[model samples]
Target: MTTDNRSTLFSPLTLPTPDGTGFALRNRTILSPMCQYAVDRQDGVATDWHLQHYGAVAAGGFGLLTIESTGVNAAGRISPRDLGMYNETQEAAHRRLVSFIHSQGAAAAVQLNHAGGRASGKPWLPGTHGGSAPLEDGGWQTVGMTDQSIAKGYRPTTKLSKDGIEQIVSDFAAAARRADAAGYDVIQIHAAHGYLLHQSLSPLTNTRDDKYGGTEENRFRLTREVVDAVRAAWPDSKPLGIRISATDWVAGGLDVDVTSRLMRDLVKNHGINWVDVSSGGLVSTPLQPSGPGFHAVLGAQIKRALADTDAVVSVVGGISSPEQAETMLRTGQVDAVSIGRAAMRNPHWPAMAAARLGVPCEDNPAAPQYWRAEW
Candidate 1:
């Protein structure tokens, strides 16, 4: 979306997409992926809750909408109820979701992930089964790419063998193909938030001695391979993005500078279209900012650092206002601002902002059959 000083975050910005697809930001606003913990246990199917949640978000007019984290392997799940794309039934359910979102004129993307050692845990709630559980609680032994020691309630995983590594890559590629077949517009390889891929990226967690560990290059190898494999399986016309923890937010963890270089490589070397910037989630706990637009500055810094690279930067976290989102885009700091908790609280936020800013509302027009007199 084009904008000037008075854009107020409602302006449209044309984002550069990957080969073969058109992925323009309808506006500078997006509905960031947030795990809804909604899945059917009987068959790993997406229930009415999933449909209504995503359908409303599409109707809200966000430029791009990503489905919540979905596991590529059974043990990769964060919670038992988390969605999966490892099977045909799950793929069918996702196809229905994609159809619903496209009907609203918004793009649909899915974040494929592996929970790593964090899998087989209880629901994310206070005093309610935090961390990985024991076998008795229906938690099978968790695994990772290395033999690094794990904390309490979590078991150290058997390091993935050469064949296992190949299998993991295949799993990601298969999932990407499924996403495409299911009618998804964009495909995101989840390498952030201390998940399987991020675990491989962080030196703090990946302590392997082979080609996949020790040095930063080795540490980044697995993630890069996954990116390459997913891109190969996914159609070149569609945009492929990766969400990364720009900073682990720990003193000893990966720094933003190194990650900035990595982003450049992904863009310049591998032709990645965008880097969805997020932070922390490396360890059980890490330092993080509490103020609004906390991650915006980091995203801006990354954007400036990669001025020579073709990758567009997108920032998440603490973005709650139309004005703030607009300012970020107008200043040329971030290509797009994504809303997480805020969008969850108010699904019509995009439509409301469009009305306030006097921009067109082509993305979210409520059907007359549903809300004619109310409008």
Candidate 2:
């Protein structure tokens, strides 16, 4: 998506994607991917909760609604209850959710992820793999670019061999294939929040003397490869996005300079249409500042680095009101703003945001059924 001078957040920006060419969202509001951990325990498939939750968010007037972190493989899930797209059954269930979201007037997207060293727990005994739950509770060994443990007592990861790396890449591509079949308009590769890809990106977590680690390029290799694989498998018309932790908030870890360069290269090479910016999930660091729009600085830094590029940028973290989103977009800090907790609390936040921004209810993206309630 090319950036143009915009007067307000209500203005539309077009995305250059195969299926979404010139795809302009009506507003800047997006329902950020918030994991519900509400899927069928047996198969990790979307159930009634997913349909109703996503449906309400779409009907709430968001221009886009992203399904939470869905695992590409069983072991990649944050929780066994997390949604998965590894098989046909999950794909069929997701199709129903996407259909409902689209019917409510928002484009549907899915966040594909591999929780890596963090894969832990199941539905009944929900907890971290080792600390809170035992292997007998349906946990298993996890993997990462290196054999590293994410926090105290978290499941230790088996360092991914060359074959293991390649297999996961294929897994992501296969998940992309399922996402296409499931009717998602967009796909977001989850490389943030100290997850698999993030652990590889940050020096604090990634410290291997192998092809998949050490240097910045080596650390970035797996994510780039996954992006390439997913792009190849996904349809040309839909947009592919990458969620990134813009900074690790610790010295010698991922920061704006490192992340910006990587993001610039990614957009230039992989045809990524959006970059969702968040921070400080790599390792525990007291340096993580908390406030509304704290991550916007990194988001703006990335946007500036890619000023010549065509990728759209979004910032998430503590963004609560329409005014904040408007200010950020109006000032060119980011092209869009994703509402996380706020959207969860009120699914129709986008519509209310529109009203707060003085956009007429009719002009907003509200459904007819919600016309009177929100308009």
Candidate 3:
């Protein structure tokens, strides 16, 4: 058999959005978005810490580097330190960061998110949740599908009205413009992990009868609208993707089947490029599974379900070893492997993985280092 050096984890992946936007990654490894919450000014600007953090991961050799979940609006921030895209100052800050990622030959993506009912103060700090933070202490009134408190020790949330819903769509579009201006190559709409979009998608949290709730179609309306808006604003030459909770881990909640279908529809009508699948976190679910590559099965099902489409699905959660990553990709469990906490724990994981999988790190395109970028 002919030997292609781009074997297993080092294989290239190309995804073209339904609207003609595309990104050809040198490998199937993607740096999953993980919030830093490192901005201390409460202004949502990128800091030197962000530069070092993402810079490390970028140099670690992932084909695509997705920045953390950034707030589309100040009021939608999960913490005061979360990155934001609603202002030029924030956009300018990200430009330098994105430049660094690109200088390393990695495609840069930004995850646009709204915390919804979960918005508040420091998540790492104690005494905060659905009922704790006062408005003056860097916490604003949070909004979601309903005004009911998600839980104790968290900010009580206000229900989003029709105008509020429209505003969210506009906000996402505005964020796309800013991301484009900042030189981000992709925009990953964060609709998963019990955030604003997931809060509305999962029936466990959304109990409204309005057009934006009740039926799955209604619950998916907001996310779909945001996708359409972002697609219009983002460049057609660059890919657009969304990160979604494939399963709520509760009976009668949004599951892989529903998520796969929703993603399919997005590809068919909304110009979606790729899907990053992670499960749970919508509500307190005791049934959530935990283990190595625990969520790959659901992501695999989504990938199988979309076999006819150009859309791709990336799986995250509990994936650390290069063998696991290679196996998942070889078996078609996922189009790409995304790493979160593992990447942070070891920014050199990709290069290390390349070595383990028999792809010489020195020769792998994914392992190339542009020290000039560092200079």
Candidate 4:
């Protein structure tokens, strides 16, 4: 409903690269990282659920598809079954999924993450009707930057020593290698949503007095180091992206101004190509200003703030329609749009959007066995 007639969301978008590799998207549509939690732990396999689920989106024509925030460490998982990149067993499953997505002409992207303070919890548990697993036994007893998280009912975390920081950076590089092996064309570092890296970036959670905390520069040290390490390990042919909270939306949290400055530094200095703008996920009672285009406005502002930086920006959060997305793109508020919930609601969203905008494209790209004559 909040559409401007002359928008560019339907137009083809080509992203810039610091490494001089050329990549062009058929459109500005992107699929943000949304957790599917459909992995089998025993064999580390992705079920037909993954193929069918993601295949639908690729077939539907989203230009870029970012898989969920895959855990770099097993204990750092958001849930026991969350997708992972720590070992070969997990990497093989992702490879199969990516092959199918690429065959459909959608760019495959992966979000590598570590859930520091917010790790391991059952998404749904019954009350009193049955017993459940603790985070250590499959519930959330994860560590954090300080002792404050434990007081808030989260797991007490070991304050990361310099060596621990180095290991995390190593984990991220390994994950990027796995992504490269798995045929991912794009890699996104998940530093947003109150995760491990974001925790280090925030003063509210990260209370360390050492180089990893204190001043803003110190706070950002971990993220910068991680990005640099990942850039080194990842192939120069692929574009690397970073997702940031943009605005924690809570008092004493990382706001857009800080995030904007960080975005500029990450892009200009560290060789990051894109910044996926999402908000919240770091609070027990997050102050989310829920509505249409709320986060998009933040995206617009951050993009403007970083006008000098060459990094391409993608905005996600409550974007429900192509019309709304186009308005933002046409105005150059953001370089691209990422839709999650809406795409889940309609796997054919991109196809529907193309039709609405009078673009030429296929509705579904799955095997004929799945979507035959109907498509």
RMSD in Å for all candidates: 2.5, 2.6, 2.9, 3.5
In the range 158-248, model 3's lDDT, one tens digit per residue, is 8999999899889999999999999998899999988889888888888889998999889888889999999999888888999989988
Q: On lDDT, who's better, 1 or 2?
A: 2
Model 1 has how many clashing residue pairs?
Answer: 6
Which has the higher TM-score value, candidate number 1 or candidate number 3?
A: 3
Q: In order, how many clashes per candidate?
A: 6, 5, 9, 6
Q: Write the per-residue lDDT of candidate 2 for residues 1-375, one digit (tens) a residue.
A: 326533366676666685556566767787899888787664779999998899889888888888999999998988766899999989999999999988887888899999888776443443522342467766678887667578776867898898998999999999999999889988999999888999888888888888888999999998999999999998777788999999898889998899998998888888788899988776877899888877888889988998997788998988996788888987788999888999889988877777787776558777887788844
Hey, what RMSD does candidate 3 come out at? 2.9
CA lDDT of each candidate? 0.78, 0.84, 0.85, 0.78
- lDDT over C-alpha atoms for residue 123 of model 1: 62
lDDT of 1 at 139: 68
Top candidate (lDDT): 3
lDDT of 2 at 283: 81
- Output the better candidate (1/3) by lDDT: 3
- What is residue 141's positional error in candidate 1, in angstroms? 1.5
Off by over 4 Å in 3: 1-6, 19-21, 126-132, 365-375
Query: Which runs in model 4 stand beyond 4 Å of their true positions?
Result: 1-7, 42-44, 124-137, 150-153, 361-375
Tens-place lDDT digits, model 1, residues 1-375: 344544546545554566634566556667788877767572456888999999988877777788888888888887777888889989999999999988886778898988877777766556865577557755667778777644455667777787888888899999999998999878777888888888888888888889988998998898888889888898877888888898888878878998887888887777578788888776766467756888998898888888986676889998877767777787788888878998889886777665555554343333323333222
Tens-digit lDDT track for model 4 on 6-84?
Answer: 3366556666666586577767789989878676652335678888999888887788899988888775666666888
Deviation in Å, model 4, residue 225 alpha carbon: 0.9
The TM-score of candidate 2 is 0.94
